[model samples]
Target: MILAVDIGTSSMKGGLITKEGYLFSYHRVRFPLESLKGDFSFSTELWSQGFLEILETLGASKVSVVAISGNGPTMVAANAQGKPLSPALMWNSDLGDSSIHSSSYYLSKINWLRENEPQLYEKSDLFLSCPEILYTQLTGRSVMVAPQEGYIPYIWSDSELERFHFRKSAFPEIVHMGSVVAPVSENAFLKTSLKPGIPVVACGSDFIASLIGSGAMKPGRICDRAGTSEGINYCASAAIGDSRVRELPHAVKGLVNISAILSSTGSLFEWYRQLTGQEKNNYKETMDGVNAVPASQGHPFFFPSMKGENLWEFKKGLFSGLEPGQGKFELGRSVMEAIGFAVRRSLEIFEELDLPVHELRVSGGQAKSPVWNQMKADITGKTMLIPEIEDAELLGCACLAATALGIYNSVSEASEDLVKIKHEIHPRKEFSDIYDIKYRRYRRACESVVSFYRDYPVSE
Candidate 1:
C-alpha cells in the first residue's frame, strides 16, 4: 500500500492506497489555521499531528512509500535543529509591505524574518516551502526543492540567489519532486507507528499534484482546480510571454504552465453558506437556489473580493445594487453569478493572450455542483471536464509516489491509469447572452470602485 497525504489550505487529508491505485481507506482532518487571521499563521505542529491522525483513523498499513504535497509559495523558517522558527506565513498572508506579491515570495519573508526576528534568523538553518517542510519533517532531512519541481522560486541559479543577497547554502540540498529524499526516520516513527526507513517521495504544490492528476499536461489544455481558492491553469507546449498569467514549468519537461488565481471564489461561497444557513452545511440548496432563479439581470453585481491582490486596490466583497426586500436566496444567486463571472474573467484574460481555453477540467469544490459547473461552462462558453475523483491533487501525489516506487514506467502513465474523467459539461447556448451581459456588468462594477479602494485601502 502507498500513503498519500495532501496538506491543503484549510485541512490535511490522507489515505492508504494499493499500488494499483485503489484507495483502501480515506480520511481528512481540518486544522485550526484561522487562529491567526492577520497573517494566516498556523502551527507547524499540526502538519505532523494531522498526518498521524489520518493514518491512525484509517488504520492504514503496509505503506511502502509516502508522497506528500501541500500549499506553496508559502514561507516556513527553520532553525539549525530543523525546528520551525515561526508560525508559517500561509499562502494568502497579506503582511508584506514591500508589495502584495512580495508577501508570497519566499525570499521576501526570509528578509522579513532577518529584520523582525534577527536573533532567530541568525540561528535559522534553512527556509522551505510548504511541501518541502512536510517531506523534511518525515525524512528528518532539510532540503530545498529543485527549481524545476515546484511552482514558485523558479530561480535556483547561483547568480539569481546572489542577486537577492541570499546564499544557496542557506537552502536545503536541492531535490526533485519525484525522487526519494530518504526513508522515514526515528523522529517520524515517534509520532506514528509506521516503520522507519520507508522511502519518502517528494511532492510539490497542490497545483502540481492536480495538474498531473487532471491529465492537463498536453498543450492547449486547462486545469480548473477550483477548491478553497480557484486556480485556473493552462498547459502550453511553449512558454507564453504574457504577463497576465503566472507561469510555472510543468512536470512534463518544456511544458509551460500558465495559471491565474481567484483569491476568493469557493471561500466566498462558504462564507455565504455560514451566513445564510440556507442549506445548512453543504451547498446543494445554495446551488439549487441559483439554478432555480433567472439571472439577476443586472439587479445585483457582487465584487467577490476577499483580500484581492495585484489589483490597483484592496477591497472586501460587496453586493452592489441591492434592492429593498432582497432575500437570502437572491444574495446567494448573485454570489454564484459573481463567482461564475470571476471564472469568465480569467478565461477572457487567457483568451487575450492567444492561448484560448479549449477545455476546462474542473475539480474540487465546484465539481460537486453540476449547476455550478454548467454555469461556469455557460459563462465562460467553454467545455468543462469533471474528473471522477474529487481528490485529484491527492491522486496526483499518489501518481508521484507510484512513479518513485517504479509502479509505473513514468508520471504520464501513472496519471493515465489513475486520473479518470466522470463527464464533460457543455455551455447552455440559451443562457450565453444573459451571462455575457452580466459579465460585462461585473467588470464595470469592479472598475468603478477599485480606484476608490486603491486610494484608501485602509480597512474600516
Candidate 2:
C-alpha cells in the first residue's frame, strides 16, 4: 500500500491506495482560517501539523512508500534543519514587479524575499516549494521535483540563477518526478511513528498530479481540476504561446500542458452560499436549490469572477439582465451557469489555438454535482468524465509511489491501470443551443467590462 498525500490550498488530504489503485481509506484536515492572512500566504507549520494529524488518522502500518503532491509555486524559506524561517509565499500571491526573472513565477518570489527581507533571505539555507518542504520534513532531504528539463526555465536554471543574482546554494538540487527523494528518517519516525527506510517519492505540482491521476496522459485530453480555484489543463504535443493562457511542460516526457487558471470557480459557489446565508445547507440541498429551476427558466446573466484573466486589474461581478420576478432559484442557477461559461471561455481559447479538447476529465469539489456537471457539458459542448476518485491528486501520488516501488513500469502505465471513470456526462443538444447564445452575450459583456477598465483605470 502507498500512503499518498496532497497539501491543497485549503486543506491536506491523504489516502491509502493499493497497487491496483483502489482507495482503501482517506482523511482530510483543513488548515486553520487564522493561519491564512495577508497577501494570500500561509505558515508552513500548518502543513507540518496537517501531515502529522493525517498520518495519525490514516495509521499507515501497511504503507510501504509515501508520495506527496502540493499546490505550487508556493515557496518556503527554510533552514538547513528543514525548519521554515518565514511564511510560505503561496501560488496566488501578488508581489508586484519584484522579479528579476520576469518569466519565472518561483524565481519572482525568491527575488521578492531577497529584495524585501534581506536578513531572512540571507539566513535561509534552502528555498523550496510546498511539496518539497513536506517531503523534507518526512525524509530530512530537500530537493525540487522538476517535471522535466523543459520546465527548467520556468523553475530555475544555473545560468538564469546567475543572471538574476540568486545564490545557487539557496535552491535545492532538482530531481525528476517519481524519483526516490530519501527514506523516512529517524527523526520523522520519532515525530510521526512511521517505520524507517520507507522511501519517500517525489511528485510534481498538484495540477500535474491531478492530470496524471485523471488519466489525461495522452495528447488532446483535458484535465479540469476544479477546487477553490480551477485549472483547465489541456495536454498537447507542443507549447502554445498565448498571453491569455500559460503553456508548461506536462508530466509526460515530451508533451506539454496548456492551461488557464480560473482563479475562482468552486469558491464562487461557496461565496454564494455564504452570502445568501445558506452555509448550513448540505450538498443535496444546495444542488436541489440550483436544480429547482429548469434549464429553460429565465435568469440573470452572472459574471462570477471579481477579477478576470488579467490578475492585475479587478473586474466587477455583475448580475446583468435580472427580471423583477426572478428569485434565488434563478440566481442560484445563474451562478452555476456563470461558472460553466467561465470554463467554456477557457475551452474556447484552446479551440482558437486549434488544440483538441474532445472531453474534460473533471475532478474536485464541483464534480459531485450532477446538475453542474451536465451544465458544464452543455455550456462547453464537450463531455464531462468523472473519475471514481474525484481527488485525483491523491490517486496521482499513489501512481507515482506505485511506479517508484516497481509495481508499474511507468507512471503512465500505472495511471492507465488505476484510473476508472464512474460517470460520463454528455451535452444535451437543447441546452447546448441555449448556452451557445448565452455564451456569446457573456463574452460581449466581458469585453465591454474589460474595455471600460482599460479606459478608466482603477488606481492601485
Candidate 3:
C-alpha cells in the first residue's frame, strides 16, 4: 500500500492507496494559521505534530509507500541539518515582502530578495516548498525538486546542482514519488506506533496534484480550485507567454502547466461571515442564502483583491458600491459574484492567449456549493465537472507515488486508472447572459478603482 499526503495551508490530509490505484483509508486534520497584522505564519512544530498524529492513526499495518504534496511558494528557512530554522513563511504570508511596492510584484520581490537577503539567499542550500521539506525531515535524505521521483539523484547532475549554487552533500538524494525513502525510522516508529521502511515518494505541488486528481490531464482542460483563494489552472501543450499566467514546474519532463490565480474567492465570503455574524448550520446554509439572491446590479463592486490582484501592480484591497438597505444576503451574493467575475476576467486572458478551454474541472471545499459551481460555470461559460473524489490533491499525490514505485507506467496512466468524474454542471444561457453584464461591470469597477488609486494614492 502507498500512503499519500497533502499538506495544505489550513489542513493536512492523508490516504492509503493500493498498488492498483484504489484508496483504502483516508484521514484529515485541521491546523490553525497565525495571523499578525496580515502577516500569516504557521508553526513548524504544529505541522510536524499533525503528520505524526495522522501516522499514528493509520497504525502502519497496510501502508508500504508514502507520497507527499504541499502548498507552494511557501518559503522556509531551514538549518544546515535540514531542520526548519524558523516558522514557515506560508504561501499567503505577506511579511516577506521588503516594501509595499514589492508585494504582489513577483519580479520586484525577486530583485528585493537579491538585495536584502543576499547572504542568506546565496547560502540557501535548499529552497523547497512545504512537501519537500516535510519529506526530507521524514526520510533523512535529500531529493532535488523534479517532476518524477525516479529522475531525482541522477537528474540533479553536478552541473544542475552548481547552477542552483547547491552543494551535492546538502541536496537530498532523489527518490521517485513512490520509492521507499527508508524504514520508518526506529525512533519514529516507536513514537508513532508504525512499522519502519515504508516507501515514501515525492509528490508534486498541491495544485498540480489536485488537477491530476480531478482528472484534468488533457490539454484544453481547466480546473477551478476554489479554496480560501481561487486558482484557475488549465492544461495547455503550448506555453502562455504572459506574466499573468504563471508557468508552473511540472513533475513530467518537457510538459508545461499554466495557471491564472485570483487571490480571493471563498475568503471574501468568510470576511462577510465575520462582519455580519450570520449564523448558519454550515457552509451549505450560508451558500443557500447567497443562492437565493439575484445577480447583483448596483454599486459597491468589490475588487476581489484581498491578497492584491495577481496580474496587476496594485497592493491594497478595495470595496465600492456601498449603500443603505443592502442586507447581508446582497453583500454575500456580491462577494460570490465578484469572485466569479474575477474568474471570468482570468478566462478572458486565457482566451486571448488562444488556449482552448474544453472543460473545467471544479474541486475543493467551495465546490460543494452548487451555487458557487453554477456561478463559476455561468461566468466562464464552460461546463464544470466534479470528480468522485473531492480531495484531488491527496489522490494526485497518491497516483504520483504509485507511478514512481513502478506500479503504474506513467502519471497520466495512473490518473486515468484512479480518477473518476462524478457530476457535470453546464452553463445556462440565461445565467450566462446575466453574468456577462455583471462581468463587464466587474471590469469597470476594477478599472475605476485602479484609476482612483493611481490618481489619488492612499496613505500607507
Best candidate (score: lDDT): 2
Q: Which ten residues in a row have the lowest lDDT in candidate 3?
A: 102-111
Order candidates by TM-score, high to low.
Answer: 2, 1, 3
Cα lDDT of model 2 by residue, 116-207, tens digit: 88899999999999889878877888899887777767778888888878889988899988989999998852267788889999996888
Tens digit per residue, CA lDDT, model 3, 101-125: 3212222223334466666556655
Provide the global lDDT of candidate 2 against the true structure: 0.83
- Alpha carbon deviation, residue 364, candidate 1 (Å): 2.0
Better of 2 and 3 by TM-score: 2
CA lDDT for candidate 3: 0.67
- The list of candidate 2 runs beyond 4 A from truth reads 37-41, 96-99, 305-314, 323-327, 451-460
TM-scores for candidates 1 onward, in order: 0.88, 0.93, 0.83
Model 3 RMSD in angstroms:
4.8
Q: Candidate 2 — worst ten consecutive residues by lDDT sum? A: 306-315
- Model 1 vs. true fold: TM: 0.88
Worst 10 residues of 1 by lDDT: 306-315
Error of 3 at 123 (Å): 12
Clashes of each: 2, 0, 15
Better of 1 and 2 by TM-score: 2
RMSD of each: 3.5, 2.5, 4.8
